[model samples]
Target chain A: MAHFTKATSVHDWLDQRLAIDTLRRVLAKEYWIPKNINFLWAMGMVLAFTFGILLVSGIFLLMYYQPNVNLAFDSVNYTIMREVEFGWLWRHVHAVAASVVFLIIYIHMLTGIYYGSYKKGREMIWISGMLLFVAFSAEAFSGYMLPWGQMSYWAGMVITNLFSLGSLEFNGLVEWIRGDYVPGQAFLDRFFMLHVLLIPLAILALIGLHFGALRIPHVNNQDGEEIDFEEEAAKYKAGRKRESKVIAFANDFLSKDMFVVSIFLLFFFYLVFWHYGFAMDPINFDPADGLKTPPHIYPEWYFLWSYEILRPFPKDPGLIAFGFAQVIFFLLPFLDKSPNAVPASRRGIFFWWFWALVIDMIVLTAMGKLPPQGIYSTIGLVAAVAFIGLWIALPFITKMEKKV
Target chain B: MKELKILAIVVFFTLVTYWLVEPFAHSQMHKHVESEGFTYKDLPALTKKGDAARGQELVMGAGACVGCHSIEAAGMPAAMDPVTNSASYGVNPPDLSNVGALYDAKFLAALIKNPAHALKVEHKFTPESGKMHPMPGFYGAGGDIDQEVADMVAYLQSIAPKVDEITPAQAFETACGRCHAVRYEKWTQIGEKPSFKKKRDELVFETKLEDYKANLTNYMGKLPPDLSMYIRSRGEHYLSTFMENPQNLLPGTAMPRVGVNAEGAEKVIEYLEDAGDPKRAERDSVGVKVMIYLLVFAAAAYLWKKEIWKDLH
Candidate 1:
């Protein structure tokens, strides 16, 4: 087998600035993505596609969207309703699609968690993914206030009011994000700037870092039910030249990827035509009105499970500190004690994992549907115990099962 | 034996999935409050099994119901109908001949009093952003004879429809059609704006017509549900009383207490009281569904036949 070649710029040989063909060839040949990857593996592609869509569309939107309350809303309405032939439709679709994409990301994250995609060498990939998720949420919040509508203004007011509570200690950035003491037109303008400008660029950087870390070792599906590829590759190292020849990425997986793409388009178009879309309000047409809060003030559905968790916290709403609780939860990969992922042979561990996730989800969404109350504390405590059980008990169960 | 084992497992799982999903699907109606829920009896129906032959003549004649509702099952909208090309795109007014196949009386009731409301307002769940017929806003602030709305409702309910209605049949075939033509004519005219009562000079027509229009419209200030099958879709006959004097129905209802003179109100009531027809087609070949299914199945069969038949030869 060829020894690892030094990173080469082929400018001298090709007399060209970039060697696109060589890069393509290397990727199409040597990339060692897991051959046994299932649907969860697809989520990376989905996230990549979503990020691209957000970037391209967001740039065009920023060009026309006015974030100052003076013209922010009406300008959006003008751009969408009257100026661009189908601009209104696109604007609404993008806003609503952001909600959907994040929900999808949340599901993708859960799939990773449950399948133990974060164990061992996969830790960087998981941590990078979590960072991307956090950045994505930050992007969503900043983007939401750009429209500066009654809904956006009130939601901003509710979120930013907590910034000054002595400990979380964002003395300026929170105010900077708001642009004023309270959410209004100034806040809206600067938010639009950050949402369209700052966060998107940072998101791109984080995505690169994520993929960079992911490629270091790929995911640690160490004990999943599938064949382990790195192990399989080690066995064939002596024969890898021939083996790689036999199973070039294009030949082995490209056709399968194409088939999956075909099935995806079939269902996607079926829903696009049949259901058209799940319609929602276009918020930018109306300026922010602080006096009123929409009766149904749930966060985007991606956060429903977390919102459910927050609902059950026994402390008073103000005392229970937002974002901190979640940042702690994000450190779950480190907290996990198992040396590697739970093996499929340890069915009891996964079963418990599945139930904990499912119950937490149900209880959280149920909490979202209700007014926050004290009784929910009991429910949250129960859910927390279950979460702790999976985090601690399941690892032990897996270890004992292996020993047995 | 191995294949049989796989098939058995597939069947077992299919049964489980169906059970889990069924309660969430069409059963949502039963899950909601029964007082204002959908029922089969809330649809259009004919009491007496009259000859479809006689029913055809009335439909074709002064009832001129076909003037608005075009049921292609009978024939495509007459190419030469008076209101041809009236809409920017032709309004293929909801077909009623086999509407029994399409919807129940409650839906029909909502559609009749207000056709625009039925399409755009009630079924707002559809993502068809534009391309809606504005027909429901026909009620005038004054001078609309609500009797015409009642008669139209009665006659529509009177058809020998697949869907059975709780209303009576004689009114549609006989009395309901007399003034109903004017109603559909009014609906046809209120094209883009989609309101009936907004027509100029609506007040000069009558006094009680004014009051009845006023009260009902006020209570339903925001886009109200369609009114075609008001009796059934409303889940009450109380709406008619509101038409007589709407204040009785809901305290703040702006609906006028008009056009329900004792005779007209009784006649309208008598018309809305029959329920029985069972010959509706539940499934037929729609162009989209049939074309896709045909394409998929035919391709599969042809491929299989080619592969296996060559070997057989």
Candidate 2:
């Protein structure tokens, strides 16, 4: 039997019914964050902020955006841009946010890897974050089709065609996904729904799951030091805050997060206003025409690294390597084979492995954008092979670490 | 020190990525066509000045300019209706109200003497192709042909609006609108509204459109693409160079050099940008304010963070 508080005012009445105070304590006030964490930890919050911007801007755009293939191009280029007041601002912000969100995700994921944040107890956090990444990728791909421009049509065509499964001949599945022989009215309509509704709901749920998974293990630190959260939190509550290794997440950690977030917004809006061209491919200015194809077709920059992996090989092998790159990141925790959970710098040969992977990814991304002719083709092939080789070498290299 | 090192690494990687993805890749993809000798030159008629009054008489009389073109700003109307002109010439002869403001003086003189040579479309309009240029060259049509060419250019320069006063939309109308339609601007090659009300008028509009497209295909070997999105598809540099000499980038292209001077080209580019990316100015201005607000918020947040962490350290 629980004793209920006397309902004096609205707050007291709500508190008694909802356990609002306890909920806040559990979720925010008493949630412990390691004090040794750096600004990199704030990327999660930045991603959330970007998603909020996307949702608001997307809703406003949806007011004028026609999902019909014929009208989508004009609605975006003319009605939204020329007729509606500040429609361009919403568009620029949405485009910049879509691209920048991927940058932050990559940083967040890399930070987690750098500090071994996925080790043992925090696997759910990583898995949930990866799920969010996939959700975001899907959301972006679907949103890209809403414009019905050349790149939008062709990219949709190429990506859907990938469903054929090489020699297995699963082209029927491709038609099923597109709802037609080619990307047309049916393709645009379904993608519009996925972009605006389905994927966004999934992303929101995954975000909640990701944050919820973080509560148990708290968060990894810059130094990867494992502090006793219960003891440090107790010490802080008892007024020995200076001696504690953890801090209350409500105000103290939030202030730090806000600081990083503000700085990020400063950079983000700069891109939105002045440097938005990168977000919008110039080739996409042309309206979709099925009869003509662009000379060179490529995915957005965020997907270029994996796209390069797929491009350098024959159809079957390329598909296999592409699949490998996509699934390999999720298997990092299992493949690492090291007992120690510390920063790469302290893990000996893992440092070399980490930098090599990072540089190799950069190379692959650069190669993806280039025309695969002569030297570029050779470079792309080597990088793809090296990427696969590095993952195979991860277990062997990390296993040799003497539990530092 | 550690933070500085990390920042340096991030910046270095960002630069490398940007360089490789944008500038370096662009260079490899679209090799720059040299602009040497592309400008129309060697028209000595332009060097010698003439009387605007005499020029106006030659233009109205011997030049037969009003037979096709309408210098609307100068109160000179076309002899034929726009629809009839499209049927006769395969495209509407553009209103030359802004020709003096848009084209180079030498190019104008050359255009009067030889339309194919001035437009750099001689390759397509060759005798072997059996396609005659609609506008016959006035090279030896009458007495004092050089003086006639010079006088006509002078008269055009006299009646035209000042270069600065002409809007980008007007420049595009005179320069490219005869062949290319910007559907987003509700502009068509015939400069006529697509009728949606009366059945007869709608039929007339449809026939005119079909005739214009068919004639354009027969004349140029293909119908020209709409200019609504060309500014985006082909970037500014590519468009500028391509306009300077179409054959340099796309060999054997039917597109003729319109002989627009540098200032005129700028206006045309501005119009394209307006159509393709209308939000650029708003985005840039609002971006500044947002950045300022963010800077202030970041400063305050940083101070609050410093204050909160002070006791912990």
Candidate 3:
């Protein structure tokens, strides 16, 4: 409705029509980030960069990937790896990115928790980030099916069978989800669609919501100091940057992010080239056989903690615990009742709680990969119970903390 | 100090997880099997050296190796085509061209005297089952049994090409192609199919295919799994050990101990990697370049970050 200026150049023309300049200023140029944050703060950018790599490499894979169960295995191992030039590079990139992205997400989430970044006003950022995590998990699970390997078929069977609701006899729900009695053509087709298109769309939307949510509250910092972003940003804009506790997100914060990302990429490509065997499970090299199961069946490393939670209990209880692990993370903002937004190191019992939770998760993840026999079973049960106990104790412990 | 502590915690957890998942869990699953008798040290014939010329004569005459297998590289052909051999034996007899270069010498001698004993598959071929190995054991046609086996071994070894010269494909064919088909390589268990001259020949071909499968299933307990992806699935170490002694992994496995020596096993594994994971070479080479590029980029990025942050207080 307002008068539009005459176009002077390409960007100016778009700015007049689409408010491009305003969008840029709002999104990047004027966006204030805390200066006290460490390299861990760059993990979100790393995750986003990894997602971009996944999208590009996945598209290349999709060009040759067959969704039919009959051809999926051959298409991936033979056609892509053998016939297509540099096909292996794209595959290693996609596989490694799919795996490494989870590692970065965990770091980002832990950094959030350690600094109480999910407190009060920053709840939406944490919630949206959690949603992105869920979307990514779905994407990874579906993408795993595209290979149609032994682990793919069995892991899909195990996970989808969970939807049968134990004693509830809701198997129809699982069949509906799989689109078949077993993971066959129908299942592969639907999963392929989800992996390539549907879940990625959901992830892109969630990523937008996550970034948008960060805009309102700004970012939390290491010392959990209550930063006056408005004041600091003004000082930064007025060239009094030395005393300012904030920096513009454009070149200043981005430079730091790029530095971290380059290092992350070094680690990532190292895996892609020499150590990609871990990402591509040895069992998965065998094409999916409905009759033959591998000696050991487990989900990828990222899901191992929750999987261990499910395994250490009886059917219904295990399902309940598994569900608890999945949903409890979303409730973190409401669960921690501390008034302080300080890092865990200064937060009395929560410091121990933070370390205990990290160690418990590591144990659970390790236990998940192990065969549930002898000592591993006992250790797994303890870790799983401890995980639930930790969450239940979080609110009580935080409520007892004195306001900083 | 806090960051260092965090890094230490991360590294410690990573190593712990790796140990638990890979090594410790693997040990729990596959308790190491003692391969004490796999070398055939108990067989006196294999322990002694023999004359290569006598060995060649035994193979060409009394040993009857050419009855089922074609030592084509050594200028000998089987009595029957692959299809015919597969129909009769339930699996195509592999060409013996690379066997000398691929199999352990003791294993070859033991296999010749007693196929079931060498493979540790005597349990499957027990007299009660009324089942026996397709190849009849040679006892020494009016000669010393040990001397005859020793001569045959020497002959086979003499005819064998240098171990390094044997390609991975040749190694795989000699070691595994009889039972396992690598469809990616267009290599089938029965080798080449015979062309049908008439409608009855087509039916006969189908019958032969069915007979071959049935025979393999009866002999091996089940049809051997395709080796197309086994290199990726079972891995190099598992495959090597399994080849050395199948019963070590699966106690009742129908797979006979092929007795592939260390070098032979390496070649077979190399071939499997080629068929299953052809991109490995490219991945390694490209990975190194990518690592170098990323290192340079990271160094530049670090410098840029330092420069930008120098303006900050």
lDDT of each: 0.48, 0.86, 0.85
| TM-score, model 1 to reference | 0.54
- Order the numbered candidates by TM-score, best leading: 2, 3, 1
> What is candidate 1's lDDT per residue for A1-404, written digit by digit as tens?
43334455555444233555677666664455554454445556656655665666676676687767776655564454346554544454456557556645765676676667776677778777888888888888887776666557776876675565435566586777677767766777667767877887888888888878866665544245444556655543455433321233443444444433333334333432332223222232235667656544545445545555544543454235334446645666666555556543355565566556555655554445444446655665566445444555644555554321
Question: Could you tell me the fnat of model 1?
Answer: 0.00
Q: How does each model score on TM-score?
A: 0.54, 0.95, 0.94
Cα-based lDDT at residue A172, candidate 1: 83
Name model 2 segments beyond 4 Å from true. A1-6, B33-45, B73-75, B141-144, B192-207
Model 3, A222-302: lDDT tens per residue?
899989999898999998888999988977899999998998898788888877777888889888899987889999988
What are the runs in model 3 whose C-alpha is more than 4 Å off? A1-6, B1-8, B32-48, B73-75, B192-211
Model 2 Cα interface RMS deviation (Å) = 1.5
**Model 1 spans > 4 angstroms off:** A1-16, A74-78, A81-83, A166-176, A220-251, A265-287, A314-325, A342-347, A371-404, B1-313
**What would the per-residue lDDT of candidate 2 be over residues B215-290, giving only the tens digit for each residue?**
8777778889888777767878888888777877988888998788888888999988887776677766777888
Residue B22 displacement (Å), model 1: 17
lDDT of 1 by residue, B1-313 (tens): 6435633643453344333223332133222323222232333443333334443554455435565556555664644332332232232233455344323334444455555443223333225645343343334223332433344444544553432331233223222321122121122122212343654544333332333334333323532322222333232345444443333444443232232223334444444322110101111123256447645744554455444323222
Q: After superposition, how far is residue A216 of candidate 1 from its true place, in Å?
A: 2.3
**CA displacement after TM-score superposition, residue A308 of candidate 1 (Å):** 2.2
